[model samples]
Target: MNTTMNEVYVILSTYNGERFLSEQLESILAQQSVSIRLYIRDDGSSDGTRAILASFAQSHAHIDVEYGDNIGVINSFFALLRKVPPDAEFVAFADQDDIWLPDKLIRAVDRLKDASKPVMYCSCYKAVDENGDFLWQSLPPEKEISFKNAIVQNITTGCTVVMNGSLLTALKIHQVNTKNLIMHDWWVYLVAVCFGQVIYDREPSMLYRQHGGNVVGAKNGFALWLGRIKRFFLYRKKNSRIAQAREFLERYKSDLSTEDSYLISAFLAYRQAGLLKRIRYAIEMPLYMQKKSDNLILKLQLILNSVH
Candidate 1:
């Protein structure tokens, strides 16, 4: 059991985030329990973001900042992950705009303090407007979180994630094409659920600030259902989410249980399956989304060859 609470290194990937970088940093600086260190990687921001990071790093011994070319968010996050110190006990992801609660680290650590296996804790977050006014609490549905669910969907939000050393070690020693990843957070969630443990917190640990510039935000009921269905068909072939699953399998196929390997391989090759095989995969595979409606949609995608 992990009896000791260890140092938490917060990894923040910043692009053109001059608008809310300081506030995010300040909120991180206020974390409780474990000692905190801030690691910022700038992805070629052509704005005042670098200057702000430099100024903050100058006065804060705990903050370390580095600048690199624009490699997109997924690669940028992996690049930041590579720079983490080998001895770091825990790792958390930070967005450029989210404001974390003061007890975020402590709350996550409390749940993970006794884990012996690779574990990650992710929490719900509050959705706020651009100016930080509260909009609504973004809670996850009380769905079964498992490798099957993770195979087709991501329930973990990166901004609220905290991973133990074992998971980070597994990621560090792995070789996978980060370019094929749909999102770094989703990939990590899949990995954790597949090979380790995942603790989902129902409470908000951070404020997810949505604005005109963000690509994803909180939606409810029918709108959220429709969006999920739309995305199911939106991505296809090798550029699909299932394609990312194929990548995940190739990277760690040797480590996967035989059943898991079979499951993922069927998902990878489902595009090539005949009508009979497609029906078999649709019925046999345990892949699912959090909501029953979305899970039904996933089954339809499998049967209709829409999950390519």
Candidate 2:
């Protein structure tokens, strides 16, 4: 790729991440084959995070830091996204505690360079502990990435996501209401699948740290299954996937294709319908999660009207 074409903007949100902030910044700076401008927004860190960020900013010309109130992760990321330069052709999301590989940005840019429309690239990641010990490698999605699947489940990991300029433009145009938003990455996946393209890379791009302070971490085996069940039952009203879907449809219905709009409308309608209709919709709608067991759980949730 041409040197000028390889420029990328990376946005990161930090919150009391002093323990691994410097290491993460060093890894981002070490990225190869791409010219990077790192924009970091500290979400009101009370720890040494602001001091560490100041030191980096004072020393590095390409790094810019913004210390702001704690508006939560979703809004903080969106704020950083708005700060990205308009001329930027590619943008990637970063976590304050992960160790990015040298080729992470380059690999994502290579995949996204030729896209003409809105497109997103996301890769698998290696889960590690706070001490950087290997935990496990995330598996690739067994099914196709589609709006139907995205409406129900998020397979995209934020730190590994990269997007073309077109998608960023679309996101800016259709601003999201963070009230019911799930995660920044999941929202991006939903938009890309509905309006453009989604590329899921099987290659591991970074060391995803599974530490106590992590906002979200990878879980596997029975632990993962049990956690999902707990969230579905215990936190249904607060973290409803149905509410997220409803928000997406409400905001983008006009721009959505006929089939896509109909699918979402039907999905929302069935949930609000009577018991028999809800059961039929649960069995009939083509929407699904990545895993078979998870898909079954989704159907059960729909049948019982527990998604709300």
**Top candidate (lDDT):** 2
Cα lDDT, all candidates: 0.84, 0.90
Q: Give per-residue CA lDDT, model 1, range 1-308, as digits (tens).
A: 86554689899989899999899999998887678888899999999999999999999998989899988888888988898977667899999988999999999888877877789999999989889999889777567888877888888888899998888888887866976777888888888888899998889999999886663466666867777656775645345677788889888888999988877887878889898998898877777777777777777888888874
Kindly give the number of clashing pairs for every candidate: 1, 0
- The TM-score measured for candidate 1 stands at 0.93
Ten contiguous residues minimizing lDDT sum, candidate 2? 232-241
lDDT of 2 by residue, 227-292 (tens): 887887776545467788989998888899999998888888876699999888988988888889
Which predicted model would earn the best TM-score?
2
Estimate the overall C-alpha local distance difference test score of candidate 1.
0.84
**RMSD in angstroms between candidate 1 and the native structure over all alpha carbons:** 2.6
Off by over 4 Å in 2: 1-5
